[model samples]
Target chain A: MLPEPAVAAGKATRGWIDPRVRLAAALVYSGATAVWQKPESIAAALGFALGLAVFFRLAPGPVLRRLFAVNGLLALLWLILPFSLPGETLLQLGPLAASREGLLLALRITLKSNALLLALLALVAPLPFPSAGHALHRLGVPGKFVQLLLLTWRYLALLEQEFGRLRRAAALRGFRPRTDLHTYRTFAWLLGMLLVRAVDRAERVRRAMLCRGFQGVFFSLQEFRLNGRSLGFAAAVAAAVAACAVLEFGG
Target chain B: MHISEGVLSGPVLLAGAALAAAGTGVGLKKLAPDQIARTAMLAGAFFVASLVHVPLGPTSVHLLLNGLVGLLLGWPAFPAILVGLILQAVFFQFGGLTALGVNTLIMALPAVIGYGLFSRFLKGPRAGALAAAFGCGFLAVLLGGVVAGLALTFSGEHFLNVALALILAHLPVMILEGGMTALCVGFLRRVQPGLLPGRPSVEVR
Candidate 1:
């Protein structure tokens, strides 16, 4: 089975911030960090992300685990960029001389990646997935797209269970995956079966929705209003992001 | 392959976002109201299928299957793939918010291209159909890597080597996906040809 939804596990400590505000803040904070080039500003952005994580009451164990996962690609960049980038030499490892500019670029990427990811974990991960989709719809994302997002979220776990059952059946039938044509073919057939079943199930689902006189729009009972506190939270996030931008571009 | 957050420069990110928005707009237009459930269902299946790890020589790689997605959904692969990546960012945190546009483009564009190039061949002879499916799978990942590399290189000249290495690294995956796609398509052709794009439901024996 897939891991439990992070929001469910962290629900006890979830902040009272509106999902819309958290989403917008996460976007602004991530966008700010993305464009930031100055080390001072990027480091400050990371610090802000850390502070947000603490304020959101995200468990450090899960936060760090996510951080390490995101850093895997960064670690690869650290290995390649420092040696391949042409600049003033920082360290000579035999024929490959690590450039100072390359090291700086790598370091900047590392900091920026962590900052954006931590911000996402803190600001975005706490919202239940359906609420995020509704928040997106409220924020003017097209209704059709939001519907697709919600539906996909709805079926992801079911199809994951279906896939698991098929794999288990295969394993029961002595299917041990190896580096061979048979393995790839077997996996492909398994996937093909899943798709076929999904399409069949889709037909049933469509009919059921039609039977209930479903329309193009999905109605939700819960409504999100931007209360005073949520607006205040938005202002604080905007100010923090603006401060980082000023640090990078301000004279 | 997803380009991580904060690595792409502003111009690249902006360009990617603009293109992805355009693509998604067109795709949404093509998606009829009735097809929403079907599209979402297929997208969910693709999302789960992508989590499947197949063995390589000494390691394993998750299946991309973008080719099959494209072949099945045509233009709608854009929104489907976007939704998949969004779910990925939300649940797993594999890719982040900032890079969503580029990542969507990287995976979805090739999917559309694969559909355009290979869907017609699917109704042909078995050998040709399988061969075309193989091409689709191979070309999708190949193109995905190329676009990712371009995204990186455009971000900075320093990323050229990284770009090249990324493309080179995808070679094995291309072969694996190509073979799997061919087999998968063959299976579908036999069992449920109607599931394939542009095929008539009467073809379902």
Candidate 2:
């Protein structure tokens, strides 16, 4: 089964906001935050993202785990950028100098990355995957693309299960993956078999849908209404995002 | 490789988005209504296939399989990979909203290039077929690394070293994927010849 997002189990701000609004807000916020060069503005964006997380009542554990994973890549940047970027040397280590500009760049990246991630988690994570697809469709994304998105989302768990079964079958046959030609060959064949089965299954699925009168269109039962509360939420988010832009570009 | 959010500059991000959008548009245009389900299912399979981790010395690395995907699906690989990246972002938070276009282009463009470079050899003799498969796999990853490196370097001149490091880091995975893709193609050729690109479709009941 696909894991749920790390939203706390209760009424949260996301429940009151429309998914389209939330998605747009997240996109705007992240896009604006991505270009901000000042550390002060980026840090303020982070603070606003944190406030959104709290308002959304996101569970801290899973959110922090995702943040940690993101930072692992940043940590690599921290190691290389400080030494490679040419600027005023803050520290010298055996002929290698850590430049102040590089350090500041790394700091800005870390802040900006965390801020964008937190906003995405707070705004977009609350909606179900299919709901998000439908929201995209309503937001003027191509219908066929949205259909593909929804269908892929529906079958991800099934395909993962199928792969799990294949792995178990291989294991039962005393197959152990190692750093060797035989192991690689075995894995390649396993994946090959999986692809073969997937092709067959896709044929069967297409036929089944055709038998059921499946056209190119997908009909969803979920309807998004723009109520007063959702509008208010949108207004609040727009205001916050506007404030961020001002802070980023002003003065 | 998924480049996390907030790493790329504005122009780089915009250019990536524009290119990805064009690719996806052409891909969607080529896809008929009746083919949507088949494309979606194959995409799901690829998504699952990507999660498989193979041991390398003491650690493991997941498969990219973009070469194989492109070979199988042709131009549809663009939309397929775009959806896959979207699902990854929504489910695992591997990439974020803004970087989606850049990430899609990084993985899918290489897929399309692999198809262009290697699809003809699938019908050739056994040795040539396998060699082409390996080339597809190796070149796809190599080009992906190069594109990613370019994206980073274009973001800032200071990122040149980091970009080079990123390309260097993909070398081992490139070798592994090359071998695996060759064997996978061999297996498909022997078991289900119709599955490979440019082959006559065989009806399987």
Candidate 3:
């Protein structure tokens, strides 16, 4: 069996807001983004999320990688939204006429989504999965739910390695993926074999943990303490989001 | 496809979250202590499965296999899927935290349906198991996309196009998953036949 891998956690950024606080703040800010319909307000929310993204000191490389993954749905939005919405026609693309209202709606969605994504990146991505699990636990999330998340994160890398070995063995056997029944069957069999191996391995692990006094509850050695600075930051975030909603809706 | 953050309105988000929470509640209750490790293993598998992509039309899409998940595990599929989605949200930002509830509902509700369909039909005969697996795999994603698309359509005034695009884009995935699921059932039926639901007396792979 492989040793318990020392998966390095994210660097602890001192003087930053508490992760629990940030989690709460992100939730509040995202909720506000969902509710506020005024396009300007959504843009402002994006600005707020962007500022947090900067403050979080996130690297542009990881941020862009995330953006690329999400842009597929946004790409679909761009394709469909511009032509299907009702209002004054802005232009024509072959058989489709782009509407001004549709374009603006699409813009609003883009801003809202991008901003929320940035906000979450700042709020959640900086912490490793386990630490985030800690935050969720601290926020009164169910113990079982957090436990599940932690377990999945813990064994995911091991599972991936197992998957790699199986794929290589298949490749060694001259099995290549293509658009045919043979390709489909080979992949399916491979995945099925992986699942069987993982399940058997898990059974062994469970018995080991049981023998070693594993309990249903997880006890963490590190605890999160909320300080004055964290409280202050949460308050400031709340105030900014409220101000944005009021301005966009009332102004 | 996972609906990204901020696209859904407040009401839609709330509804999705509520439904997901309810599902999770039932799932937790139904799950046995012995099954926790198995669920985690499958959840881990589902989480990494996203990295395996299939070419579909112009752009490529990844395998979710929520159907296979549900068919094997029953109600536990909800939390398994939720855990996987949370990891994706954190690691790739494919979906946002606020939209977690909606994403869970979109993906797992269909899994629940697939479980019912598969369990009812999977144990009969080889041909029947293959067909059931194919249907489960294909319709699971197809229905999930439709659920999400309807949510998008109702969230705002001008979202019909978004709904149409989501439904249409996922059609290819539906067919792909069906074929994959059929093949997988065949493979599993031969090898680790115990993983599948049926009589103990069966032939070898």
C-alpha lDDT score of every prediction, in listed order:
0.87, 0.85, 0.79
By TM-score, highest first, what's the ranking? 1, 2, 3
Candidate 3 error regions (>4 Å): A1-12, A68-76, A92-96, B55-60, B197-205
Best by TM-score: 1
- For model 3, how does the per-residue alpha-carbon lDDT over A1-251 read when each residue is reduced to its tens digit? 22121111124344357878987998899888888888889888888888886776666776776677667668877777778777899898788899998788778888888888888777766665577788888888877777777887888889989888988898898876666677667777778888888789879978987898877766665578898999998998999898887977795
Instruction: Please identify model 1 stretches exceeding 4 Å from their true place.
Output: A7-9, A12-15, B200-204
True contacts kept of each: 0.88, 0.88, 0.65
Best by lDDT: 1
* CAPRI docking class of candidate 2: medium
Docking class of 3: medium
Please provide, for model 1 over B1-205, each residue's C-alpha lDDT reduced to its tens digit, 9 standing for 90 to 100: 8988878998899889889989999999999979999999999999999988899999999999999999999999999999999888878887788889999999999999999999988877788889999999999999999999999989997678778988899999999889999999999999998888765434535
Worst 10 residues of 3 chain A by lDDT: A1-10
DockQ of 2: 0.75
